[model samples]
Target: MHWFLAVERRLTRTALELAIIAMALVVALTFYQVVTRFVLGHPSAWSEVAARSAMIWMVFLGLAAAFRMGSMIAVDLLVDLSPPAMRRIVHMIVGVASLVFLAILIWYGTAMALRVRSQNLAGMSITIAWVYAALPAGSALALFGVIARMMEVWREPAGAHDDELKNVEGSV
Candidate 1:
């Protein structure tokens, strides 16, 4: 169990680092686009598309990081008010539901990405499938995050405040 958690933590950290890099690329590309279009009066056609693609990757990868950190929005008041026994059940149900939803995203997103693998982005040589791949990749990461959270919940005692506090801190 400890080894599994360590792996998950490492994976999440890697995703986060990649997302940060993507975000930086997006910012740089966008700045370049603006400067070239306005200041230089010669816009690079590929810059906007490249920035948009990077933004998409950044958003998707960031989603998994947020999910793993318990930063996703949720109405937890009901769970908090429930009895300790019921709270565990509710948490399990929520985790299962999230897994199911992410699984669907992974399935359909991968299919769509493959379907469009031959298509290239306008004004760029890159394949559109690479951008689309972020959908399934992010969903798979989120699925792992959900499973890890469920395992943590099962391992901890009911009514444990650590996870709750972390969630609360993340929200704020």
Candidate 2:
């Protein structure tokens, strides 16, 4: 579990960093596109396509960090109201559901990428598959994050979450 968690931590960190870079790229490209189109009176189709691609990659790559942080979809009120055992069960169900969703993403995302492998971006020479690849890659990283979070939760003492819950409540 320790080894798995260590690797997961690294994966999450890397995913987050890449996501940030992708976001920055998206912003820069979009800004350039705007300046070229509006100010220079010459639109850049390639920059627009590149910005969109970067945005897609940014969203997908950030997925692992969101899951690891427990900021993914949740019915927090229900979980907070449950007994410790019930809370664990709820967490398990949510974790399993998340894994299943990610598995589906990986399966279909890979297929989609393959289907479009021969197609190029509208204004770029690169295959569109490169853009779609983020789906499976990010989901794979998120798998590790979900498993690590589940493990961390299970390892906690039964009453340990009470204080944590209070802290969360206060923050919100």
Candidate 3:
């Protein structure tokens, strides 16, 4: 279990790096688009499509990192109010439900990616499927994050702070 956790952490870190790079690329591309359109009086068609594509990848990749870091929003008031025993039960239930939801996303996302494989983006030569592929890829990464989080939750005591709000409050 510990080894699995270590691997998940490494994978999550790599995903975070990729997401950062994608986000940076999106910003750069958008900036270039703005400068060319307004300053140069000539906009490149490819810049808009490229920026959008990068943004899609960034969003999806960031999802896994956010999940792994427990940075997502959640209604944890009820869980925190529950008894220790019940709290653990609720955590397990939430974990299982999250896994199920991610699994569905992976399944449908893969189907959609395949369906659009032959279709190209409107202003680019790249296949639309490549953009769609981010969906399943992110969902798969999120599945691992869910499992890793479940393991952490199981190892810790009940009523522990496992969401972002608690961390923010503690820092303040």
Candidate 4:
């Protein structure tokens, strides 16, 4: 469990760093597009496509961090209301559900990415598969993160769980 969390923490940390870079790329590309379109009176088609692609990468890469921090859209009310013993059960159910959902995403997203491998982006020569690949890749990373969080939750002492408010603030 210790080694698993360590790996997961590193994975989530790297994902967050990459996500920040992707976000910066998106901002830079969008700024370039605006400048070329409005200021120079010449629209840049490739920059728009690049910006959109970067945004997608940014969102997907950030997903792992969100899941690791337990900041994903979670209904903690049920777990919070449950008795101490039941809380672990509730968490297990939620964890299993999340793993299942992410697994489905990985399967379908890989299929979709492969299906689009031969296609090109709207204004770029890059294969559309690169854009689609984010789905599966990000989901796999998020899956690991979810598992790590579940481990932490299960290891908590009875009645040691944080309240829903702490969860909302990503304190879990």
lDDT against the true structure, each candidate:
0.80, 0.85, 0.80, 0.83
Q: Which candidate is the best by lDDT?
A: 2
Candidate 4 runs further than 4 Å off:
81-85, 163-172
**lDDT-superior candidate, 3 or 4:** 4
Per-model TM-score on C-alpha atoms: 0.89, 0.91, 0.88, 0.89
Q: What residue pairs clash in candidate 4, if any at all?
A: none
- The model with the greater lDDT, 2 or 4, is 2
lDDT of 4 at 121: 98
**Residue 142 CA error for candidate 2 (Å)?**
0.1
lDDT of 2 by residue, 110-165 (tens): 99999999999998999999999999999999999889777866777775754563
Ranking by lDDT: 2, 4, 1, 3
Estimate the TM-score for candidate 4: 0.89
Those runs of model 2 whose alpha carbons end farther than 4 Å from true positions after fitting are 162-172
lDDT of 1 by residue, 32-138 (tens): 99999999999998999999999989988877777675554472765767787787777788889888888888899899999999999999888899999999998
Model 3 clashing residue pairs (backbone): none
